[model samples]
Target: MVSQTSHVYRYRVDAEDTIVAVDEWWLAFAKENNSLDLDEASVVGKSLWSFIADHATQKLYKEIHRFVRVTGNPITVPFRCDSPTLRRYMQLTITRHDKQHLDYESVLLRAVPSRRLALLDPIQQRSAAFLTMCSFCKRSLIEPSGWLEIENIAIKLRLYREQTVPEIRYTVCPDCEDHFGSNRQKLESSSEQPPR
Candidate 1:
């Protein structure tokens, strides 16, 4: 049986961003999260882009990858990978292994019990309505205010009263985009050579 106590998950990708390898902990985490499709046989040899659901997040990741390869420096960033009942805070470090490969290491910073949110449950039934959720932070987009946490979204959107929750559509929020955008610009300017 895979250990749930393993807090570190790592994976390696080729220069083209094809998944080449994954640590056992990664498979264990996937299984724990009920993501059976992310098993080794299904994930390995697949393009990383295929796993990212939104274009904006993909674009940001591409920028980060380019920056790392060009500068030969690892980039570490904090992100949330929450489950229905747990709020998992994680840190990811992307290190260039060589000219042809890069390693991504994710360390679980912490996890706290959270109120069960149907919207976050993978097997939950969905209504025709859709909610735009930030891919990085997992916050739902509440118009006018933009992005808000699940708790606030629940009250503001009155999600608890619904018979079925809206389907979540992942996208990068403006805040996340701006944050990565500025970092990308800084990295590009600092790099002595442009990305190939």
Candidate 2:
């Protein structure tokens, strides 16, 4: 078990959603994760959308941002930011900074050591086959078995016997879409004024 450090990384963006500033914690986390390209110097001034790989996840974020802006309320959502050997659970809170700006704070909630799958290893060799992964839950789509966590998928598919792991392609799983989608709709309806 990885002890909870409660590490928080924060960044701010303008109305156009371009990253304006990132805190030192953000930089430190990126370095610790071996994500050099995510360093402050490279990430600052870039569109947030540039970092998101898939459209479904991007759309979910867009809706969350819009909800915060319109309702002037902060929303916290759970997500996974996993490393090859660790499953990192995190919570992201989006708060309105002003009418046209927002602040995003991500806190590490929990982390657990798990058997590593080459599929999650950035440096691992990849096969031609592609695996569709849920961006929010870190689950992979296994046909006939539906969406499954990486550990189960690895065993079910017997990836250990393969020379190379399948490449990961990210998307939103139906469960996540339904959960967030319903909440978004509720927020939208509540924020609407009835009959002026």
Q: Number of the top candidate by lDDT?
A: 2
> Model 1 scores what on Cα lDDT?
0.82
lDDT of 1 by residue, 18-115 (tens): 99999999988888887878899999999999999888888778878888898888888778888777778788999999999999999887777777
lDDT, candidates in the order shown: 0.82, 0.83
Ten-residue region with minimum lDDT total, candidate 2: 187-196
**Which portions of model 1 show Cα errors greater than 4 Å?**
1-6, 158-163, 190-196
Task: List runs of model 2 lying over 4 Å from the truth.
Answer: 1-4, 160-163, 190-196
The TM-scores, one per candidate, come to 0.89, 0.89
Clashing pairs in 2: none
